[model samples]
Target: MIPRYTTPEMGEVWADTTRFGRWLEIELLATEAHAALGVVPDADAVACRERAPQTDAAFVAAVSERERITDHDVAAFVDVVQAAIGAPAGSWIHYGLTSSDVVDTALCLAMRDAGRLLVSAADTLIATVTDLATTHRDTVMIGRTHGIHAEPTTFGAKAALWALQLDRDRTRLRTATETVAVCKLSGAVGTYSNVEPAVEHHVAEALGLTAVPATQVIARDRHAELLYACASTAATCELIAVELRHLQRTEVGEVLEGFKPGQKGSSAMPHKRNPISAETISGLARVVRSNLLAALQDVALWHERDISHSSVERIIVPDSTTLVHYCLQRLNRLLGGLVVNVDRMRDNLWSSRGLVFSQPVLLALVAAGRSRDDAYRIVQRNALRSWEEGVDFRQLLENDADVTLTPQQLDEAFDLARSVRNIDRVFSELHSMASR
Candidate 1:
């Protein structure tokens, strides 16, 4: 992943240093596991662990040089670690384990840590949206159907929908993390020819992963699931980004991302405060989504396994995780610092001269014994007249002979509060999901 899209913490996790360090740790642990089976002496396992950190820059350079000849990355890594410890202790470094054993398990560890950060970011966004929903529970706005005002609704209802979606995002990430947290030490063909299933079980327990039943690698489907979850979460963030972009439009001006002091929206335009962060999240979401398609393509490989998936995983896994983390973090900040224009929302609510309240008025007339079609026509005609002639829908309905509703009934129909009478129930539902 590029620095522009990657956060430092996530970027560091996938750094060569961190990756090699984990590889070294896995090698040492495998040696320890083998020692327990009397495959190596306890002294050698301890010595390997003690000297494991010494596989530093010079050692990696030497081993990478060896890979130029051996043409195997894991084989070179093992040779390097063995050279660091020397003689008998070095001999037990990668005993009874394959490259995927170390590589897949260590990848799980990185993903576990990344999942924690992503969930935290999602929770932060959910909290901000929840707070916004509660604060604007009665703040009315015109709800649109086909880019035109269709009905009345509170801004809180819109925010509550976002909150509910984020709750689902958290659930999806949890499932993805669990699915990918699997370990395999079954060796080449997964028949446990050299290493026993018990060794795999123990190694999985040691690394806080579940033992996979059988694997050429730890099942590419698991990786696919994880990438899809990450991309899907980013897609949801894009939904919010789109909404924020729409609301921040000059014509709308109903909501805006917080404009920081000293921040510039344009190079030369003096009066500009754009929703750049929201737009940023939206833009980066495309990268995450594109990476997920690559992960899906990785699912089908040559029987047992193939290295084709390996190279792609090297790019998609770290890039997708890091990109999603950056997006979630930025979206959290955007939601938390959102500047909602309640007065503008209220003003826009009446922009169509109470035409947004047409549906309720139509329904009320139908309940008063008018045919549904007749009620709809009456409401539609009055609404179109109000929009074009700047007359109030309610006043027109009151004067139209075709309309049968009483003044009291018209008053009830025009009530936006009545339209959102279930707001509290919706909020309660959002809170319940948030608690989970």
Candidate 2:
């Protein structure tokens, strides 16, 4: 993740200093657990905390050089911390824990922080979409199917749908956070050969996590669950991007990305105001979804564990979190500054020659003693003629004797107000959910 796309707060979470600091926290927790059991001196535990604040940049820089030969990140980190803490106290640093005791647990702490940031971003996005929907609750627009006007629906309804989907994404994300918030201090093959189960439990409690029931390296499935949730959330983001692209199309200019003053859309075309934000989000979604394959592949590691999953996770976890955060923040800002063309939406609603109100007319005729088949035929006939001949569907319905309804009844059938009568109910539902 580059500095440009990554926000300062989230960027810090993935920095080496921060990751090293989290690793030390996990190590200290383990030390505290050992000290409580009389495995390490209480004074040594205090010294451990004071000595190892973080793996300093100068020390990490030098230790990374050692990692080239060692071919192990956790080993290199341990060696660096040992030098900082001096011999005796440093010897008790990772007494009864394997590399994963520190690696996986510390990774959880970092992920927990990252998840909190993503949740905040998601909440902001949902609020922005909901606010926009409320403002445009009655802003009529042509609801299209296969790129052609099929019926009338409010722009608010479409935004509300996005908001609702985002809400589900939020829930999925929260579950992912909980699923991964577990730690394991089991030795090499998860046998408790060197470390006791009580030590693992105590360490987990000290680090604000739960101990895994039985596992090797904290169970890769939890990691997979989080990635799956991230990919699914990215899919929802892509759905919004697709919609924005369609609305910004030249022929259907019902909405647009905000065109800030002096913001150039293109060097060649001065008149162009592209939906770049939406397009960028759409492209980033592919990256997130593609990473999911790696996550699933991570699930089938060799026996207890393997390095196969390790390499993939180093990329996916941080990248996915950063990408999702980037997308949510960008999307929220885009929606907040969205340029809605209410008049254009109303104009496009009628561009299809009143055919949008066809369903209401068809159902009205069915209710007025006409067979469903007969009513469908009457409405479809008039709709097709209006579409082909550029005539009003309502006028054709009024003239057709098959449509036994009076002029007033026909007028009521074509009313846009009637089409969106349930909008209030929908908005109320969203408002209630958002408040919670």
Per-residue accuracy of model 2 over 66-92 as CA lDDT, tens digit each = 799888888887888887898789888
Q: For residue 424, give model 1's deviation from the true position in Å.
A: 1.4
lDDT of 1 by residue, 1-436 (tens): 8788878888878877778887887777677888888888999889988877555677668878989988998998888778778888888878877888888888887887788778887888888889988898888888887788878788898999988988888889988988888888888878899887777877778878888865667778888888988999999999999999999999999998898888888999988889899889889899899999899999888888888998898888998899889998888788888899989998987877888787888899899999999889988998889878989778898899999888888889887778888878888998788676
Candidate 2 wrong stretches, greater than 4 Å: none
In angstroms, give how far residue 66 of model 2 lies from its true place: 1.5
Clashing residue pair totals per candidate (backbone < 3 A): 0, 0
State the local distance difference test value for candidate 2.
Answer: 0.85
C-alpha TM-score for every candidate: 0.96, 0.96
lDDT of 1 at 363: 90
